[model samples]
Target: MDTNVITPEGYAELQQELDTLWRHERPEVTRKVQWAASLGDRSENADYQYNKKRLREIDRRVRFLRNRLSKLRVVEYNPVQEGKAYFGAWVTLVDEDDQTLTFRIVGPDEIYGKQHYVSVHAPVVKACLGKAEGDEVRVRTPDSVKLWEIAEIRYGLAAADR
Candidate 1:
């Protein structure tokens, strides 16, 4: 398995989700499944079937989380990363059309549900890595190559600034 890279905040979030699933959700679903099974006929027991499926899904997720968490390396902000686009850096870009876009470079595990988070493995991030503010970056997409200028780079203070 590939090493899972994650930000400190993202790691904490995943840990919290795992805890919730293990301590609360899984137990609750298991209880429901047991109660439904006690009603005797499971062939047509909707509650039992539903809860059983839910339990399996929960267990699968728990297993995945456990394995993933073990492999995850939480990335902390480094002072040396200042003034350049690196992992965990908040970068603002301007296109040739003067359109502004801002996003933070984070690991794949952190990008879900966050529109402003870009995966570190993305082509745009690959282009932005080691680039300082005012540097031009080119990202090759399936259709065309996109050009952007790094307008700003900030680390550690991104949340406060936003």
Candidate 2:
């Protein structure tokens, strides 16, 4: 498997999530599981079944987080990677239709449309790497390859100023 590269921001986010899962979520679910187990006939109890499934899910996530955290290498902010796109570059691109999309290239764990984070291994991010501003790149997808131009590329997390 390709080693996942994580930025400091991504690592911190994962730590926060792990902390929440362990300190808050786990305890709450454990209480529910206990309450469900106390009820008679666990095999037939709906609460027991639901809670058991939830506990299994939580445990799985916990294991994933632990393993991911252990393997990740947190990237520190460096000024040298400014001009060229790299794994943690925050890039802004414009599609053929002139639609603009802004995203940060991080690791797999940090990716989601809502988070504006794309995995470094993603096709689009991979295409954008080493590409400077005003460069046109063809991003290959399972459906069809789309063309996009690098309108802008900026680093630093959070807002542009931050």
Candidate 3:
């Protein structure tokens, strides 16, 4: 399997989520399932059915968290490597049209709920990696090639690492 690299903060966030799911959410769902089971016949009990399905979903997520945590390696800031972009770099880019966008390079699981976050495995991140501030990069899509200028770069904290 390919090794996954994540910032320290991202790792911590994943661990925190895992803890919440296993310690809190899982037990709560289990209890609901048991309570629903006590209400009526198994085939027709809606509560039991809902809670059972919820438990299965929770178990699946928990297992994914456990497996991912085991496989991912957290990348910590070294200060000396801050000038150019890497896994944790917060970069701002301006398109040829002068429209600017900012994003932090993160792992796949951390990509949700953030307007400016990009997965390290994404095409934009791959194009931005190893680039320094003021550098220019071109990203090719199936439709067209977008040319972007690196307006700024900062090795900012990953949410879990901070």
Using lDDT as the measure, the top candidate is 1
Residue 55 error, candidate 1, Å = 0.2
lDDT (CA) per prediction: 0.90, 0.83, 0.84
lDDT of 2 by residue, 21-53 (tens): 888998998898899889778999888899888
Instruction: Rank the candidate models, highest TM-score first.
Output: 1, 3, 2
Which scores higher on TM-score, 2 or 3?
A: 3
Q: lDDT tens digits, residues 1-162, model 1?
A: 223888888898899999999999999999999999999999999999999999999999999999999999988998999899988899999999999989988989988887789898888988999999999999999999999999999876465434
All candidates: TM-score: 0.93, 0.80, 0.88
Q: List the residue pairs that clash in candidate 1.
A: none
Clash pairs of candidate 3?
Answer: 8-161, 9-160, 9-161
List where candidate 1 sits over 4 angstroms from the true fold: 1-3, 157-162
lDDT, candidate 3, at 39: 80
- Clash count per candidate: 0, 0, 3
